[model samples]
Target: MRILVILRQVYEQKSIQWSYEDRKLIYQRNSYNKSDLHALQWTREYKLKADALVDVLILKKEEEASEENKLANFGIQRCFRIPSNGSEKEDAAFISDLLKNESYSLILSGYETEDEHSCALLPLLSYELGIGVLTAVYQLEGKPNGQLTALRKEERGSLQEFTIQLPAAVSVTSHISKLRYHRGRSAPDFTMIEVKRQLSKPEAVRRIEAPEPNIWYADTPSEEIPQLRLLNIMGFASQSNNSNNLQKQTDHLSKAHLYFTAERLVKWLKE
Candidate 1:
């Protein structure tokens, strides 16, 4: 059984980083970067060091796509490029083509790209390709009949297990494992991979520039708190019955009286 690990080549050096001190986001060009760390983590956990046949699908922007070819030491089969269309759909379509021919039994990709408008594309791709998809996968176990069981990490420190047939897609989360390093500097090898460059020339409908950021400060007057609302009387029916079972009526005051007076007695009688 063959496996294809789809990975994105990001600027391992300069990328965005969240900052709690500034209460805003910041970009880190150097120092401990995430993409490289993430890639290395997958390499170690997946055991893709030596005899692993894998392919990396990277999308590069213009002015860098052609020149952005660098060897990732981990066993990567091939690296395909998509034109810098600047749209999520374009990127998805590019990935879809790479996955079209039913090339590999299992495909592993990161949960989200490094782009600002980041979206988990595994669901859409799986729907498009008619393949099973699992997200936040931490542990992958080989099973009989070319099937694999995925141990996924859910919210609140919970984990869920699922079994998927071969030829399925998975969106891997960063927290799944730790990144590893490759000692040698030989160029990565690729397998029998195929990708179509221009699926369709999409015309640009419109382009709008983002507005500049503006920091503003305001001052407001402090006022005393208002007194709590006081009910004239705790109506018997309103207090007894739940809000949902309490029906609304057109005759408002009469309805209230009927509800409080007769309904209350009827409720006790029914009980």
Candidate 2:
């Protein structure tokens, strides 16, 4: 069975900040961070399990071609590169065309990509390919007749296994396997290809910038009114302050407090 594994090089968490303005995604580099751990681990898992052969595909920005190829010496003997168009939707279309042209039994992808394009592609691939998508698969066992069994995390803190039919797409989590130091026999053959983006490029979700109409902020010190502070809701006040005569009686009554009130009502009724 042939497997097509989709991978990507990612900036470490908090390495880049994303902002949007006028249909553009504004990228602000905070620091040079590493790739996503989950993405790396997923790639490493296939390196060990892929017995017959595995084809890897990496979606990377043009500028990051060098940095993203750090995995070349690893399990990837060669990879099909899909130049990113900065649009997840457009990227998925190119990927779908590639998968459809090729005959692959199963398609694998990381649960989340560097910029979360996998969020758009994973499901889109399943729909476009007319297959089922089992996400977060950590372990898998394939059976004859195009049936495969996969293990994934359950919502209740347990592992759940699924039997998915073949011709399926999956988005896997890091729990699948641990990353290794072993590299493939040779440097991976990397091929870059151009994609003609057909869809409108993915626009930034929403832009954040200096306010033209207004700016909404919470707890701004510049505002004249000090923010209200909540305190002592848990009855943390001084014991002396709570030690009034009525308070003392209420505490002493305990279970008898309701009985005292009932008796007073009965007395008033009789009168």
Candidate 3:
């Protein structure tokens, strides 16, 4: 199975210890927390199941060697580093283009990165990809006949067993699977594709690394607190849909009471 794992890096809480020298963004880049273990968990699971060639997608303003090093160390041979401003549309577009010519049996995503960026992207990704998604999924394996098998966490911590066909995405919580530290693994060569550079002519394949920091910094505005929403699933009847049942987040439930449709669900997800 060709698997694409999505990951992100953020400043470690209480670990961002650095002072700016003459307005340069010179904070310790290594201050990001250990979110790599989450990606490692997915890699281990999929590799054990099907020796899957795991690709990775990272949302960032630009590619840096430090970040690529993080993804490439985890047995990943490819990465889609999409430029993002944390909007749902940009997230959809980047993923859509990546899927335009290629398809994968499994797409793994970490539920919440160090800064909870991916948590907001989880539902939006499923709606935009228009594929069967099982959130908080694990114990995933492939059957002999090209079918996928997995488990989900339902309400009250009940484990729900389900199966979906090939070409499905699963959002995994960071702590669900145990992680092991890997060493002596030579850095895997990964092809890096930038979202903005897709339309331009292909550049020569060269080493991926970060350029030296500029003298000044471009400050990104702070993210505003997201407003609460309620979704109603009054008549959610599946049409023999052999799809992976996705679990819901606890606090976002709005106790809405209305008919269910994919359009409405997607609209609500974007909002």
Candidate 4:
């Protein structure tokens, strides 16, 4: 029973940014920031992670001739070099070809690639391979006939243990378990070889042109109004020279009070 683990070198999260141009999320320039993690460290950490699984082997995507030998030192048993045009679809097709000649009991890949491609290959590979795909598997219990039970995570922090049959392909999520470290006895000789990749030229689906921006600015000042000011106690009063007449009017109003006539009260009583 042979297990093949697919490893890829991807850019850090910060080094890439998503832009919503058109209807899809397109990767744009890193006007954002840089990431600290590198592929070497990531692969080294996985050495510990791969150790936890039952009856499984780890491998790198063979690049040059010496890649597999170099990876062997890091405890990788076999390596698969995909073509340069290796999209997820191509990767699935390549795996299918392997299933025809070589016997691989199971294929394992990360739940998502470190780059923009995430979960794109899993379902396709599973469909093509025609086997049960157990994704995000954290723990595994190996059986005699290559059948195993894996504890996989569902939505909302839930777990479901799946009893998977042999000849399966899976995408593992990091949320499933704590990654382990690698402690190997010796490093294997790194050899270099060119593995033929299965890929074709991608078609130009759409052409995009940056639209002109609609930016405008205005320079305007707030309008100010003049306010009236108080002059003096009586200087700003009306220019009426008849002070005696004004006093007479004021005195009449001051002395005027409410006078309820008896005739009005009699009218009210009649009503």
Screening candidate 4 with a backbone cut-off below 3 angstroms (N, C-alpha, C), the clashing residue pairs are: 48-180, 48-181, 64-193, 65-191, 65-192, 65-193, 66-191, 66-192, 83-197
Q: Give the Cα error of residue 123 in candidate 4, in Å.
A: 2.6
lDDT per residue, candidate 1, 1-271, as tens digits?
Answer: 4555554534433365556576554673322224433643564445533334556555544444332223455555566655444465666666776667657766666766654435455567677777888876777666646677788887566789898987888776666566654555544454433344654555657543343578665333232322211221322233344563455555656766877868779988777
Model 3: per-residue lDDT, tens digit, 1-271? 7877766555554544334344322443432224445645767665766667877777653443455554445666677766555454456666776677777777777656564344655556667778787777646556888886777767555678888886877776655567665555455477877556333322345343334576855443232422211111222323232342555334554445233345568888777
Off by over 4 Å in 4: 16-74, 180-193, 203-271
Q: Give lDDT: candidate 2, residue 197.
A: 38
List, residue by residue over 52-99, the lDDT tens digit for candidate 2: 355667766555634433555444444676656566666676788876
For model 4, residues 180-231, the per-residue Cα lDDT tens digits are: 3345634554333335654566543655445348876543322232111132
- Two-way lDDT contest, 1 vs 4, winner: 1
What TM-score, computed on C-alpha atoms, does each candidate reach? 0.57, 0.61, 0.58, 0.52
Ordered by TM-score, highest first, the candidates read 2, 3, 1, 4
TM-score result, candidate 1: 0.57
Better of 2 and 3 by lDDT: 2
RMSD of 2: 10.7
In candidate 1, the residue pairs with backbone N, CA or C atoms under 3 Å apart (3 or more residues apart, or in different chains) clash, namely 40-179, 40-180, 41-178, 41-179, 54-77, 77-190
> Any idea what lDDT model 1 has?
0.56
User: What RMSD, rounded to one decimal, does every model reach?
Assistant: 12.2, 10.7, 17.0, 21.7
